[model samples]
Target: MQWLFGSDEDILKLVGRRGSFLSRIGVAVGIKDSDFPVFRELYYEFMEQFKSRYSVYTPRRVFASVDVRGILIDGSELKEYMLFLRDFVNDVVNTSGLYVNFVFASFGTSRISLPGKAKPVSVKTFIESTLKSYFAYIPVWTVIHRTGIKRARVYVDSFSTSPETPAWNELCNNNEVYVVSNGDKVNLLISAADLLLGYIGTIIKLRNKKPDISELKSYLKPFGFNDDRFRIYHVGNRDLGHIIYKDPTVKINPLLYRPFPIVYLIPELSPAGLLAGKDERKLIESSHVYEYILRYVEEQEGSLKIISFTEDFKHLSAGGVVVSLGEHSRRIAEYLRLLGFPLEHLNARELIHLYGGDPRL
Candidate 1:
């Protein structure tokens, strides 16, 4: 296997997602539950040490380091490398600190049911058994400690497939505080504006420390800003989106921009996102419009490669190359013997181990 980038182990470790970003910061700064005052002291000390170094970011390279620890220099491979770092840091936080709890529910057998016949059983038997199991158990303290969110209270509701989410309607009708059902599921209505405001407040809190400007700059470059580009561009949807910017001194222009057609690595699309949101892969796999898009991209002259980035321990049982994009089309020709996709193989076995899977592989 010709290593695609630098050290395979390093790349794999870089992408392993388990921890939380806050825990990573705590570890880096050598702080513990000695509490907020202790954390602030350690944070300042870490900032002072970090400021002693020089950092730089441009289109081709990023350099940042901590004394007596290690240095990272990602050149041209900025996007992938940063992604690895972000995931690693978050995984640390998630494991060492705490993460919000989420529960998934599936409605009963029939998609369409006649009125009154619905028994309204528990979505999962546990919903009737435990308070912790029914609703999303987001720890308010963890959010405050890590993300600096200070939500006063939270309300949860279940939703069904119907217009008013039959579950929510029952709760409202009965005027019940914690009404729940396996049948009628209502939606939990989170206050988006409030969440966004709290998030911004947290960012402001972190920025107030006057962090090493160079370190911040290098950390941000991969999402498309370089020293030469002075302008920024926003594309894609509101929540899951990408941003691009350039510094004027580097002579980079925002106008001459093109988004690379990177392959999406996922186990499967969530049914909720598929039914409520627009997933490109699901749309292409299931619709006639996808055929048109595939034919158009394939007919183009440029060559492309379809890379299968996955884990050896996992498999998408509904195996098929669900989507195709761009001129060069290749598939993991060996992947269960699929064809006509621009294909490259990422060692899924290696990835699984890097993610702390069993040694047997």
Candidate 2:
């Protein structure tokens, strides 16, 4: 059903393109632009032609990190990935006949506990700071290193963080970077960024267990992109030592990062149960201590109903009702969050305390 990728899972999948007709259209849509209809028709023809040429960069397998409490863009492994990603962008720019005028990116969600705070700060705020610091190394650094300047339009996908935040303002003031925080996935190219990010995230979760994570043929079929779309470099134990994309001339300097213990939230898994790793399993298990995770994976064989603690969290074990969760219990919270459910991350005791008592009690 035309799945779009703009979730916490797609944190690293920030899509950006510059010097294209699409970018031009995106930036210049006046309130009384009568040429929109003609432009829209041309855009439709462009999408059809794009699909026919197989020009979309869909990967058979996705690659992502294990979500550890360290730098978001630290270490060589991630560096290798980003450099390769930059190459991929270059490829797209060349193939699509688009100039690299600006790069579009939207920040995804993340959860991290702030010092002296009872809970984590806003997911988007923490991610914004993390990403701003991250770009100082790669893509942004690489662009300046290769092109000799840092002047580009950065269309930010709006999240909780406002464009007026100090970091964002500083970036604009220093770099003349035109900041558009309300970019949407209305165009084909931008949507590819979402797919690309989701693909990396999926692979990161699956790469640890399987030799090649592209085994998700059926899972990816619904999205109209399959394994054959792009090449996957399958190397065991992904580290900086392995030249994944392998560009000998691309020398990488040590990246600077601020260390913070970050807790990654998760979405429901693939149809074949192939998208989670040991770290994710641990995250699911640890939530047991907090009580968001009620039953273990084993306990949820064939239950019905997915829950968001907001509306569906009514305690029910009697009175003609039984509160039960589906097999994707770990993902229920995340799914609810995506659907715009405001769920305060709470432990079982905290929930009981908030609600006075578990109604099932």
> Against the true structure, whose lDDT is highest?
2
Per-residue lDDT of model 1, residues 1-361, tens digit only: 1100000000000112443111001000111232324323432343333335434111111111111113333443334334433332233322222112111122223222222434433322312221122122112111222333232222222221222222222323432122111100011112111121122223323444322335534544442222442111111122011011112122211111111232223222332243322454454344333223222222221111122343311222323222323211213224433533443333333333433444243
lDDT of each: 0.24, 0.29
Please give the distance, in angstroms, between residue 356's alpha carbon in candidate 1 and its true position after superposition. Answer: 6.9
> For model 1, what is the alpha-carbon lDDT of residue 33?
31
- lDDT of candidate 2 over 1-361, digit per residue (tens): 1111111112332233432111000111111124334433443454344334444322111112221102223553555344433433334322332322112233233454444457766545543553342232122222223334334333222233211223333333434332111122222223233334433444434333222235534443443332333222221122112111133233222111100111123333432376554544454444423232222111121111223234233422111112222245435544444655444332334433443444232
- Displacement of the residue 75 alpha carbon in candidate 1, Å: 39
Tell me the deviation in Å of residue 220 in model 2: 18
